[model samples]
Structure formats: C-alpha cells, structure tokens
Target: MEVNEMAAEECKAVLEHASLGRLGCSYENQPYVVPIHFAYDGGYLYVFSTSGQKVKWMRANPKVCVQTDEAQNQSEWISVIVNGQYEELPGPQYTAERKHASSLLAKRSHWWLSALGERQMRVGDKLIEPLFFRIRIHSMSGLRFTDEKERRG
Candidate 1:
C-alpha cells in the first residue's frame, strides 16, 4: 500500500462528509476520548451534547483533537485529524451562532437522538437539556492510503 498526505482541501472534504468522530480532550494530564456526532461548517466543528464528563474536561482544557476516517478495507482508507479549541455556545451572546449550528446539525437524520438518549439513560425521567458547542479548528491534517494495485490501475 502507498500512503499520501492529503491536501487542506481534501481534509476539509473529509470533514464535510463525515458526521462521526472521536473527540479527545485532556484535563490535568489525564486524557479522555469518546465518539461524537458533529457537523463541520466554516472553520468549526459543531456538536450537540449533554453536560457531562467531556463538558467538564473541555471547560477546564479547551484544547482538543478530533479524528475521523473512511476505510474501504485494510489497504484503502482516508483519515483526518483536527486540532482545535472548544467553545461553548450558550444563550444570550451566542443565540445566532447556536441557531446556525442547529440548522447545520439538523440536516443529519436523527442527529439529536444519540445525545438525548445517552443523557436520558444517565438521569432517568429527568429533564434533559442539550448543550451546543463548537471546536474552533486550529489545524487539520490527513492521510490517504491506496493499495499499490489500485494506484497502478
């Protein structure tokens, strides 16, 4: 297999097409990672989530990493990594931005279910208020791997 570095445009394309990724955050030297559903727009990756461990960790340390990939097989794959800072979108000052995030995320069917469902499971019969946040992309890099046969073809 041959591996090639993806250009900025190619990386953006991957982020635009992918809705799921692993979000990595660190607090006090301990690292945590979890699967997240996100929408990439402009220079940020928007996410809808409940107040939980991740939220607390991110609040303490805004630095984060997001990784997503598309794999056809062992010999063919595209992977992207985004390094960014987290920004919470709260009401009052961020009303407009929150609306924009909501619109973009709504395009993905059942986008809110997983977040809400997880929150419900954690706090049974309790009111679940979802929070919106965005990862301000600082940099992105990606790699594409293609089998030698495919490249030659």
Candidate 2:
C-alpha cells in the first residue's frame, strides 16, 4: 500500500493517546524489546528513562522500532509500528522538550503520583536523573481492523 493512503490524523491520535509500547532495538546482533512509556508530539516520540543498560544499548544503536496497539474486539484491533532513530535532545531543545514532556506527564491520571499532583522537579538532587529522547520517525505503517475488509472509509 502507498504511504499516502494511510490516515495521518488517525495515526497521530494513536500516538498521542497510547501510553505504552514495546521498543525494539538490537544489541550484539541479538534482538531486544522492552515496554516503555512514551509521549508523541505530532512529529516525534519522547521517552523518559534513567541512565542504565537500556539507555546504553540505545545509545550504541539509535535505530529502533516502537509498536503500540489497541484491541477494539476479538477480531478487530489497530496497531502502529514506528520505525525510527533515537537521539538525545541536547541544550535548548532538551529544556523545551523536557518541559513539554512534563506537561504530558501532568495531564495523565493513569498513575498514582501523577494523579495526586505535580511534584517539584529538583534537578540536581534526584538520584535517578531524567533523560528525554526524541525518536525521529522515518516511516510508519499501520494495520486497521478493516484492512482485511477492504474498507478505506
């Protein structure tokens, strides 16, 4: 199918509302996939993580895939697969993106702490330092529930 045939608005909505996805990357020629919380800003996927093994692996290999899905029924579901490259946003971009990401965090009621309210972001004192990453979407493909039905409406 042609890329232009896909619904841009639908894909954007999926990225915005979906909170969890499996991020796929390879290390040492072996495949790895891990569940993560992500926020989308129309063009890129922002993921928050503390420094550790996963971050290290991603740094080594920037190219990755993010897959998210929602089931509407036993026979129907939609999934978006984003194939992109990850890069750590630096300097001014980092500052702005972090604030933007924080707003997204503040709006969500799914988690307990977030539901309670905003906490002070003490940059220097926090043990697990926050990192913001941008995944630049190179290409994406989605499967709709009606794909099998030849439905294009």
Candidate 3:
C-alpha cells in the first residue's frame, strides 16, 4: 500500500460530503473525543450539540481537532484532520450566524435529533436546549492510501 498527502482542495472536498467526524478537545491536560455530525461551509465546520462534557471542556480550551475519514477497505482510504478553535453561537449576539448554521445543517435529515435525543434521554423530560457552535479551521491535512496493485490496475 502507498500513502499520499492530499492537497487542500481534496481535503475540502472530503469535508463537504462528510456528515460525521470525531471531535477532540482538551482541558487541563486531559483529552476527550466524541463523535459528532457536522456541516462544512465557508472554511468552518458547524455542529449542533447539547450542553455537556464536551461543551464544558471546549469552553475551557477552545483549541480542538476534528477527524473524518472514508475507508473502502484495508488498502484504500482517505482521512482528514482539522485543527481549529471552537466558537459558540448564542442567541441575540449570533442570530445571523446561528440561522446560517441551521440552514446548512438542515440538508441532512434528522441532523438535530441525535444531539437533542441524547440529552433528553439523560435528563429525563427536562427542557433540553440545543447549542450551536462552529470550529474555525486553522489548518487541515489529509492522507489518501491505496494499494500498489490497485493503482497499477
């Protein structure tokens, strides 16, 4: 198998079509990672989530990493890693940005359901306020792996 570095455009293409990623955050030297659904637009990755451990951790440390990938098999795969800062979109102050995120996320069916449902299950009927945030991408890198034989074929 051979691994090649993906260009910026190629990385962006993956993000555009990817709906799921792993979000990594650190607080006080402790690292935490979680799976999330996101939308990519205009150099940012938008996410809808509930107030939880990740929110608290990210609030303390804005620096984060997001990883997404597609694998066809052991010898073929594409993976992307993004290093960014987290920015929360709150009402009144970020009304416009929030609306934009909502619209972009709406393209995926039930995009908001996972976050809300998980919170509901944990809180037990209490009002679950959804939170919107975006990861301001600072840098991204990607790799593409292919089997040598497949490349020749």
Candidate 4:
C-alpha cells in the first residue's frame, strides 16, 4: 500500500489500543501466523517470545507483518496492519524499551498490575526465558468499519 494514504496518527492510535495481534512470517516458503502480545511504541512493535520455533524462524527471516484490531462496539471497529523487519533487541535496548512500554501499560485502567507488573521485571531483567524482538516498521495502515467504511493502505 502507498504510505501517503495512511494517516500516521490514526494508525498509531489503532495500534496502541490493541494489545493482541497476529505475527506473520514465512518458513520454507510456507506462510505462518501466530497470536501474540505486543506493545506499540512511537513507530515500532515490541513482542516477547520464548526461544523456539517462532524465534528461530524470525531469525532466519527477519521480515514480518503484523495485524491488530479493536472494536469499541458492534457498530464500529478498526484494524491496523504493520509491515516490518524483526530484530532481536539487545540487553540495553530491551531494558530501555521495556521501561517505556511497561509505563504505558501501567497507565491503562484495565491493565492487571500484578501480571503485567511482573512481566515488566522479567522484561527488564531479560529473564522471561523468551526472546524479545523489535519490529521496525517500514509501512503501516489502518481500516475502519463503522457506519461507513474507510481504509488507508
């Protein structure tokens, strides 16, 4: 999709409001998709995962795509798509990003402090037994389906 068509602010809003998303990549020319939790920073996606198949696959192929959606009610919905390259964030990088992400998460009224709070520590300590990847977005778009349908892609 053409980058000019997408409004950066609206796309960012959609990303921030949605926590769960689908990470898409390829393995042996076969496409793969996995559900995961993510944090959307200024223009990047932060995802945590244990070292295993997905992480290995991503390493072998850093290119990826992600989709996140949110619905305020039956009458309205918004979905955002991010196309990017994935890179494992090093210790220092993860620490800094984790602190910012955790702070934003903490600000949400529905956020479970105990669970998300513990994750913050694990992320800070790089002790989740999981690999942390920073998805550097190259292009982003959003689609809104409310009383009217609008798309930016």
Candidate 5:
C-alpha cells in the first residue's frame, strides 16, 4: 500500500462530490467535533443547524476545520481536510447570501427536512428554526491511499 498527497484540484474535487463532513471547532482549548451536511461552492461550504454547542463554540472561536473522506475498501481511500473561518449568514443584511446558500442546498432533496424533524422531536415545538452558516475555506490538503502495484513506473 502507498499513500500520496493529493493536489489542490484533487482535494477540491473530493469536496465537490461530498455532501457530508465532520466539523471541528475549539473553545478554551477544548475541542468539539460533529457531523454536518454541507454544500460546497468555490471557496465556501454552506451548512444548516440549530443553535447548539457547536454553534456556541464556533461563535466564540471562528477558527474551524472540516474533514471529509471516501473509502472504496480497506486500502483505497481519500481524505480531505479544510481549514477555514466560520461565518453565519443571518437576518436582512445577509439575505442574498442566505438565499444563495438555500438554493445550493436545495439541490439535495429534503436537505432541511431531517434537521427540522430532529428539532421537533427534541424541542417539542412546531415552529422549528435552523441557522445557515458558511465556512470560508482558507486552505485545504488531502491524502490518497491505494495499492502500490496499481501504479506503473
């Protein structure tokens, strides 16, 4: 088996094809990681979630990281890591950006349904509110693992 560093374009390609990623945030030296569904454009990743621990932590420290990976088998895999800054798109000031995010996310059927359903079950309220946020990707890197014999000299 051999592991190789993926080029910038390769990393972006993986992000483009991926909709789910693990978001990592830190506050006061403590780390919290959560799985999130997101839409990737050129330099940003749009995400939706309710007001929770992750949000609180992100609000305090905008620095964040996102990880996404795909595996065909035990030995064949690609993993991407993105370091970014968190920015929440909210209210009237960010209407356009919010709409853009909604439009991109809408491409995936029922993207918002599960979040609302989870909120309803947890809060027992019919009026469910979810926030939209975007991560401003600063840099990204990736690694690919494969059988060495598959590549020719």
Candidate 6:
C-alpha cells in the first residue's frame, strides 16, 4: 500500500463532498470532539447545534480542527483535516448569513432533529432555540491510501 498527500484542489473536493465530520475543540488543555453535520460554502463550513459544552468551549477558544474521510477499504481511503477558527452567527447582524445557512442545511432531511432532540432530552423543554455557527478554514491537508490493485486497474 502507498499513501500520498492530496493537493489543495483535491482537499477542497473532499471537503465539498463530505457532510459529516468530527469537530474538535479545546479549552483549558482539555479537548472535546463530536460528530457534526455541516455545509461547505465559500470559505466556511456552516454547522447547526444547540447551546452545549462544545459551543461553550469553542466560544472560549476559537481554534478548532475538523476531520472528515471517505473509505472504501483499508487501502482505499481518503482523509482530510482542516484547521479553522469558529465564528458564531447569531442575532440581527448575521440575519442574512443565518438564513443562507438554514437554506443550505434544509437540503438534508431531519437536519434539525438531532440538536433539538438532545436539547429536549437534557432540558425537557422544546423551546430551546437552535444555533448557527461557521468555521473559517485556515488550512487543510488530506491523505489518501491506495493499494497495488487500485493503482493498477
């Protein structure tokens, strides 16, 4: 098996095609990671979430990492890691962008269910408002592994 580094365009393609990733954030030397559904647009990854531990941590420390991948087999796989800064889009100033995010996310069915469900389970209230946030991509790197059979035909 041989592994290769993916170029910038390839990395963008991977990110564009992927909707799910592990969002990692750290604060006070503790790191937290969770699965997130996102929409890649322009230079940001728009995400939806309820006010939770990850949000609080990210608010304190903007630096974050997101890892996404596609795998066919052990040797046929691609993984991308992105370094970015978190920016929460909330309130009047970000009305347009927030709406845009809503539209993009609406493309996927049940997009709002997970967060709202979690909120309901925790607070036992359905009044919990959803939050929209974006990650401004600073850099990305990807690795792909290919075996002899894949490399041949």
Model 1, 1-153: lDDT tens per residue?
788999999999999989989999999999999998899999999998877889999999999999999998777899999999999999799999988888888787264656587668877844456789999999999999999787456
lDDT of 6 by residue, 1-153 (tens): 789999989999988778889999999999999998888889899998877789999999999999999998766999999999999998899999999987777675254556577667888865456689999999999999889876566
Residues 4-96, candidate 4, lDDT per residue (tens digit)?
334878898778767789999987898889887787787788765656677878889988999988776555677789999988866874787
When summed lDDT is taken over every stretch of 10 residues in candidate 3, the lowest stretch is: 108-117
What are the per-residue Cα lDDT tens digits for candidate 3 across 1-153? 788999999999999999899999999999999998899999999998878889999999999999999998777999999999999998698999988888888786373566577768887854456789999999999999999787566
- lDDT string for model 5 (10-70, tens) is 9999988788899999999999999888889979999877777899899999999999999
TM-score of 6: 0.88
Least lDDT summed over 10 consecutive residues: which range in candidate 6? Answer: 106-115
Model 5 clash pairs? none
What lDDT would each prediction earn against the true structure? Answer: 0.90, 0.73, 0.90, 0.73, 0.87, 0.87
In model 2, the runs with Cα more than 4 Å from the true position are 1-6, 90-93, 109-128, 146-153
User: Against the true structure, what is each candidate's TM-score?
Assistant: 0.89, 0.74, 0.89, 0.70, 0.88, 0.88
Model 3: residue 146 alpha-carbon error in angstroms: 0.3
lDDT head-to-head 2 vs 6, winner: 6
Which window of 10 residues has the lowest lDDT sum in candidate 5?
A: 108-117
Model 5 TM-score on a 0 to 1 scale: 0.88
Tell me how many residue pairs clash in candidate 6.
0
Q: Would you give me the overall lDDT of model 1?
A: 0.90
